[model samples]
Target chain A: MLELGPIFRALLRNKIGAILIAVQIAFTMAIIVNAVFIIYDRSQQTKRPSGIDEANTFYINSSGFGDDFDIKGTITRDLEAIRALPGVIDAVQINAIPISGSGWSMGLQTEAGAEHDGQGVAVYMVDEHGIKALDLELLAGENFAKSDIRWRGPAGSKWPAKVIVTEAMAKRLFPELSYSEAVGKTVYINNDEPMIITGIIDKLQAPWVGWDNLDNAMLSPEKMEFQSTRYLIRTVPGMRDQLMKTVEELLAENKSRVIDGMRSIDYVRERSYRGNTAMIKILTTVIVTLTVVTSLGIVGLASFSVNRRKKQIGIRRALGATKASILRYFMVENFLISASGVVLGAALTIALNMLLVSALSIPPLDWFYIPAGMLVLCLVGQAAVFGPAKKATEIAPATATRTV
Target chain B: MLTMTNVKKVFRTDLVETHALRDFNLQVDEGEFVAVTGPSGSGKTTFLNIAGMLETFNEGTYQLDGEDVSHLNDNQRSKLRNEKIGFIFQSYNLIPDLSLFDNVDVPLRYRGFDAKERKKRIEESLDIVGLANRMKHLPSQLSGGQQQRVAIARALAGNPRFLLADEPTGNLDSAMAQSVMELLKEINKKGTTIVMVTHDPQLATQATRNIFVKDGQVSEINDVVAMHVANG
Candidate 1:
């Protein structure tokens, strides 16, 4: 242990410089802790299974141009052609793709005329082959039968009588019941239309990646033919590129409609969470830049201090202090400053995390990150001061005899 | 005891090489108080620095307390200095931030003494300096004479075998310089060997013997009273 009393007294003589360094370290600690938390959260989100065969699947968007074009007929023919193509396993027309950040949502309640708005649930509209195309597992109950499929066109609008809800959605609606018990139960949509739950999927995320309720989703057996129709086509492994080109050409050959877009589900998911990925990148850059700048700041300050105290160092050397003692003096001085900054940073980290939790709805930062951040700062502080401390130890004791 | 034979020190630069000390020889028995006097640039300070082991001589054999120091590395030299030699500077080069007690405690701390031993040495040294009541005062808060006495106390704290003082009273007035010289004489009476370098003739006369240097070589050595009568 060093003599901290003298070290602190020395720092008090240059309180401004020492305080500035401490404050810099505090802010650096705050940013690094929160950035790590956010980065970990976003990367975990990207790693989640989308309940769809994202690697080998692609989607094509088609919109009818003229009134004479038969929209329903074109969708039916397009899906059939896509399914029959080489390397194509299964194809289904969906109202919206999973993890696309764009989908339809409705409120579901256990009873009609309930005063509350009920739980918001993501709604996916597909046919009998939807589960197979998305590779979703049926954990309980049964898949939708072919006869139960309903076609809803522009001429008429009606809700599906049967729906397949994810296990998360089932728990939200009927928390007290088992997954099997949730099946065959009636849930009212818009507090009017009654639909029976036919199946329960193990897991299916919502379109929005960071939503608190991403797993609350349901699938309706309804054939939707909108102005712009979307077809999810799953192909054999390593055949997405070939299948996308073939399907795009096949749809282009028909002049009745225009191909708005065609991309693999992997690309779609990347685009949907582009904001989240960008945030991660930006936070990482800021963290790296802050660490560098803070370290450089410490280096600059220590170098300046060494230059200013050269005579004092010479005197100490003349008084029989070894080179290692002088070196440790400066290092201990820097550690005290860094340790002070870390304490201040812990409080600042809590304050900043509270703001983030309230404004962005992110979870509170984990407790372990604080000590982890402090360790990093301590190491950085010591490394930064080493160069200047070494310089101080080289001062010859003969310097004390000189007038200067 | 201290001994040096044919000591040489050179200061080198890009354009010139200056011989600060050449063929310097000196020997002082234990408990002897010797004063070195010289004109400016005559290398009296260089001699004192070498004697204190603060600087290395390029060519010489030096022995302090029966140990050869000519081949010791920096760490060994520092340990020897801490244990056996004390240094006093013209400017009273006490660390300004530390109190008088802490300033005196520096060499004792370097000696690896425990806290109780260090405290005992510090208090005893301070008491010997006649400023025992001012232990908590910083160097900046004291007069030049007081600061120089504190430096002396610091040198005495380690109970060194010898003390090397480079113009210890150069910055003080006549009264202060006389008091400091008297203190040195008292310390020497207690059997601590002391070597002081100074230009003040009156103060130089107080030591047991005086050596005069000219052009990096010792010109003459004489007893203080005999030199006074010879100059007359």
Candidate 2:
């Protein structure tokens, strides 16, 4: 039989130790729940796909230094050499690599005026081979033909007449139309320069992983005539590392240019999300440490309670309480304390989560974490109290008759 | 009814094995009030503990109400003790945190009685001890004599057939002692078998039978009060 009423009243009379342990449990639950949620959120962020072929792809930069570096002719020759390699799938000279933390952005509007609001998008300058080199699926329209490619000088201001967009950017630009229907639609960049949506790709991420519109991007068919150029290359399976070394050595052979910033997509992704990984590790440590401290607090309180009530326990045993009953008594007593702690902890968890949402701009926590935390903390309390309660059962009933 | 034959209890340590009881024997019929008196280190408490099943004897054949309890497990012994025996300690042994009603309800809870039945028995027992009106008062709020009465009420609430008391009035003044003695006598008159262990010879004379314990053995005596007076 459970002695809940008697145990509660007893706790009320002696509230100091019980209250301290309860508060410890409450604080521990609050911190642990929120910390676990944060860790999970960070892990999910790190696990999200960047919508690129990260495993078999890499990128390198070529910054020509001499006066007559032949930027356009050199880019053409470099593309031909890379594509003609044995294991090379495709290659393109792009203005920026996706998820590489450096890129260009522009806003587009359906209406041709500054008075209308526009959606933001990351811009990638590439030639006809952009989709194939980046391993993208042309979901809604045909890929760019070679005749559509154009060349612009360093200070050129002319805009391309046609552009291809990711499905995410297409949806944002034309929410009322399906992505396939939006393929031939016209949108204006730079407030009035009209650009037609020539095609739509299935998925692609922005260069900045932390952007709210991470998947909003567009590919413009243009070759750059500048002092530096970046080349994106995709190799067949198990050929990327050998190709990366070969390409770096080949680019370095030309004395007019320096080969630097040669990195794989995997390395780029890791460097991009390093902060989130560190946060997850730190929060996991915090959760574990807090749970251990709270469990120890429960054990300390229960052990002291048992030592103080040795005589009472003996009296209960003499009054015909079995060892099981004595064990039940203490266990049930600790349960009551744990129940109170979890109740208070629920409120504290929500309050802390609210503060985090407002201060850190994180999304609101899912509702189930509160109850899950409560159940876990209660189990911890019960397990921690078991050893002391068992020791209490070993007290002899003859202790009741002993004067000292 | 209770009987013990050649009961042997020894306390052992690393270097010593002291005999607390050796070849002790006793018998008490139904409806008898027996007082056991002895000096310090005489094993009176040890014998009472064994009879109450609070301690197991090393070698003995004991029977309580026709059941051989020598080989009972701890759980079985607890059940038998709950169903058959009640104990009153010298210190009253009331859980100080609980009210009089809750203290009285403890033993009945172990007996697995329903709440309504337990309530009825607790009220009736406390009324017998004249503490029913103060059932909600904590034990610390009561006097030593009143606390002992609560202990007696706790014992009686379970409706056991046998009662074992160790120095029931040891902490009381003479007036309170006499009052408790009269209460014990009244309980005995109602056909409850009781065995009381005490150092007070005057109190022992109040029982229908007196047995003196010396050096772990017993001898029946009829004039304990006179013997105590003569020794003084």
Candidate 3:
């Protein structure tokens, strides 16, 4: 171990450059630690299971071109033709799929016109085949029977009295009861319409994955015939792409209706989280740039110090200090500076994480990242100072002593 | 004790090759205080550097303390230097950021001495230079004479077999120079060999022996007291 007193004294003599590099290290640590945490969180979120067969599924949105055409009849015919496609397994018309970032959301209340605001929940309208088509597991309850299915108009004039809810939504409405007990419970929508929960799914996510309550979703047995209708079709394994084109062409044959959009659920999900992916890219770029800049700063200051102390180094060499000793002196000095920076950076990291937590409601940064960040910065600092320290060792005691 | 036989040193640039030391030969016995004097660019400093093992000769043999060091690698030479040789410079060469004690501690640290031993040597060396109370003072805080004394303390801290001082008092006043000379004489009396290079003839007369260099070669050697008696 080196004697740190002399190194500290030397650094104190040149405090300005040392402080600047320290501050750079501190900010780099804070930004990188937090950025990495957020990126990891977002990446995990994107990979979360939507409780559906996403790989084998695609969605088609259609709208009739003319008013004289029967919207319900046209949707029925298009769904029939799509279901008959060779590779298609099952098809159902849904208002939206999870992770699309846009859908219908309403509140759920145990009693109508309660004084307190109700818990908000995403509302998905599907038919009797909606559960099987989306591959949702029925947990502690039965699937919706055909007699429970009903047609709901655009204004929701025809509302379903029976509804299927995810286990998360069930727990939210009746937190005092178990999953089985929450079944057959009455829930009010929009503070007026009463609906009874008839089935419970193990898991289903809301359209917006960033929502505070991502899993609070409910399924209604409504044959929704909107001006623009979305059909969620699940295909046999490894057959989605081939069937997507065939289905689109068959749906477009009517000529009275146009295929507004046709995309795999995977593509829709990716588009939904595009903002997060872009954020990761940008944060990664900033991290790389900051690390490079901080390293260069350390190299620049260390080189300057080495150049200014050439005579001193020569004197030390002449005094029987080996080349390794001279090199170690400089390295020890840099380590002192880097250690100071890391200590300050650890505090800064916590402060920055607290601010982000309060402002953005993100989870607090994990404590492990602090030491991990410090380790990286210290390694970078040492690596950056190595070149200048090596140069100091090359100073000849004879030549430098003669410089006077 | 030090010996050099037909040592040749050449400095080369793209356009010229300069022979800094050509067929240089010298030897100094143990416990002798020798002063070397020469005109500017006469290679006295070059010879001192080679003698200290701070520079390697292009050709020839050098033995320090009866060890053949002519073809030793850098690390081996460094080990030998650390074990046996100490150096002092014209400018004192004290690190400005270090206290006097730290300055003395440098070579001891390189020598891998324990802290207690290093502290004892540092204190004793500083007391020899009469700066024991000022161990905490930085080099920049000391006067030229005081700083040079601290340099001497640093050189003595390792208990080197011999000292190679190049113009040890070159940057001091006459009174300071005389004081430093007395200190060197006292150290020499204790049986430590010293080879000092200086341009002052008065200081040269104080040494037991003196050598003059010209054009990278020793032109003459004299016993200063004998020469004075012979002149009388």
The segments of candidate 2 whose C-alpha lies over 4 angstroms from its true place after superposition are B221-232
Interface RMSD of 3: 1.6
Which runs in model 1 stand beyond 4 Å of their true positions? A155-157, B225-232
Ranking by TM-score: 2, 1, 3
Worst ten in a row by lDDT for model 1 chain A: A1-10
Fnat for each predicted structure, in order: 0.61, 0.77, 0.64
Error of 3 at A131 (Å): 2.1
lDDT of 3 at A344: 94
Q: What is the lDDT of residue A197 in candidate 2?
A: 94
Writing each residue's lDDT as its tens digit, candidate 2 over A1-404 gives: 89888889988989888888888888899999999898888888888887778999999999998788899899999999999998999999998888889999999889999998888999999888999899899998888889888997999977899999999999999899999999889999999899999999988888998898989999998999988889999999999999999998888888889986889999999999998888888898888888888888888888999999999998888899999999999899889889899999999999999999999977888999999999999999999999999999999988888998
Q: Which prediction has more favorable DockQ, 2 or 3?
A: 2
For residues B101-207, write the lDDT of model 2, one tens digit per residue: 99999999999999999999999999999999999999999999999999999999898897899999999999999999999989989989999999998899898
Model 1: residue B11 alpha-carbon error in angstroms: 2.1
Task: Assess candidate 3 and give its lDDT.
Answer: 0.88
* Candidate 1 lDDT by residue in tens digits, A1-404: 37677778768867899999999999999988899899998888888888888999999998888767777788788878888998998999988888887898888888877675677888888888888888899999899988888888767656888989999999999999998799999988887678899899988888877677889899989887677788999999999998899889998999877899888889988898788899999999999999999999999999999898888888888888899999999999999999999999999988999999999887899899899989899889999999999999999988889987
Q: Which candidate is the best by lDDT?
A: 2
